[model samples]
Structure formats: C-alpha cells, structure tokens
Target: MANPQKPPTAASKSSALASGKLGQIIRLLQRAKGATIDDLTEVTGWQAHSVRGAISGQLRKRHGLAVSATPDASRGLVYRLPKAGGTR
Candidate 1:
C-alpha cells in the first residue's frame, strides 16, 4: 500500500515568511521603491546569486507572488511586485 501524504496547511505556508532572510527580502520588495540585489544583500548578507535564487525560487514559485524586474538609471536592476490596479 502507498503511504498517505499530508496536505499543506496554512501554518506551513505562513511559516515560510515568519522569519529569517527570505522574509526580510519580501518585506523590502513590498516597499514602494522595491529593492535591488545590493539592498537585499545588505540586509540578508547573502550573495547576489542567493538573493536572485530566493526571489525566483521561494518568493515567485512557492509564494505565488508576481515578481518583476525593471532597469533603473541609477540602481541598475530593481525587483518589485506589480501595482495592484495595473494589468498583469
């Protein structure tokens, strides 16, 4: 017989954002100015690649957030969530 699997609970999902570096990244990106890799690394102390991976793998895939990257004249690359009223 196959083993049964437990479904994901709300606590499990919420726990992912409860604390640590990933949570800090999400909060930083949630701001109006969003955040750059430099900003994320400054806060989380992770490498540039790790920051990108967390945004792509955890925030985008696992949390289902709409993460977009746009170029800035001064900041180079900035990552942010799309505006709520704008078209996806």
Candidate 2:
C-alpha cells in the first residue's frame, strides 16, 4: 500500500510564501517605481481592500516591514517599501 501524505508544517507554509502572491507583491514594491493597489489586485486576484489589508496586517505588522504610500497622477496611490535606513 502507498504511504499517506503528511500535512504541511509551519516551515513549509512559510516557504510557500516565498513564491506566492504575497511574495510577488513584495517584489513589485521593491522595484524603483513600486506598485499601486490596482496592480496588486490584478496580480493577486484580490480586491482593493484585501490588498490594503495584506499590506498593513501581513507585511507591515507581522513582518515588521515599512510600507509607504505616495500620490500618483496615473496610478492613484503608489505603495513601496522604503530603502534600508530610510524613513517611511
């Protein structure tokens, strides 16, 4: 008989984030131009509110990341992570 598969552990779940939508969003924000809520929502198939919540609750609070927002004529609000040693 075949062996039963094991459930995902904490390590596995965390590792999955490295390649999941959240990871992709992080990479997008790390770019020079950063990204907007529409961009994140389109990429992740999440609503605008969910994207904001993820940025605030997950990336900012849980991960201790500093995310900033600035006005953009074309994209509404652009979000990005400030450079190391830089103020948010």
Candidate 3:
C-alpha cells in the first residue's frame, strides 16, 4: 500500500516562503511605507498579476498571512503585512 503524504504545516510553509522571491515580497511589505504592485514586480522580475497571485495565493492563502492592501496617495495600492501586536 502507498503511504499518504501530510500537508505542510504553517511553520514549514512560512519557512519556505521566507526565502527567495516570496521573502523579497515579504520584506517589501514589511517596510513602513509598504510596496505597490510595480515595486514587487520590479524586485521579483514577475508580472503584476504574478505578484498579486503570490500575495493572494501563496502569502494569504497558503501561509495564512493577513496581508493587506491600502490605498495611498502616491501609490495606487500598497500591500503589506499587518504590524506586529496589531489586530487584523
């Protein structure tokens, strides 16, 4: 009989996400000013949609990160993680 594979835990997924392009995006989001789609695309060499997907699919969905986007005067949408010790 074949063995079943367990789904990844939040810690493992977070560790995986904390490297490479995803990490880059996280860092940008952690910044006080946050980052726009253009900024994420520029850093990761990905299309705007791809960046959005990474945020929505990978960060928010997979990692269960409460990534939020707020409107900015200079930037259209600034995406970022919520402040530590802050409520979502």
Query: What are the lDDT figures for the candidates, one per model?
Result: 0.86, 0.87, 0.88
Weakest ten-residue segment in model 2 by summed lDDT:
79-88
In angstroms, the error of model 3 at 34 is: 0.5
lDDT of 3 by residue, 18-67 (tens): 88999999989888888999999999999999999999998889878899
Better of 1 and 3 by lDDT: 3
User: What TM-score would you give candidate 2 relative to the actual structure?
Assistant: 0.73
Q: Where is model 1 more than 4 Å wrong at Cα?
A: 1-8, 82-88
C-alpha positional error of residue 18 in candidate 3 after TM-score superposition, expressed in Å: 0.9
Q: Which candidate has the highest TM-score of all?
A: 3
Task: Compute each candidate's TM-score over C-alphas.
Answer: 0.78, 0.73, 0.78
Error of 3 at 74 (Å): 1.3
Off by over 4 Å in 3: 1-12, 83-88
Listed per candidate, the RMSD to the true structure in angstroms reads 3.7, 4.5, 2.8
Local error of candidate 1 at residue 45 (angstroms): 0.5
Rank by TM-score (best first): 3, 1, 2
Ten residues in a row with the worst lDDT in model 3?
79-88
Question: What is the TM-score of candidate 1?
Answer: 0.78
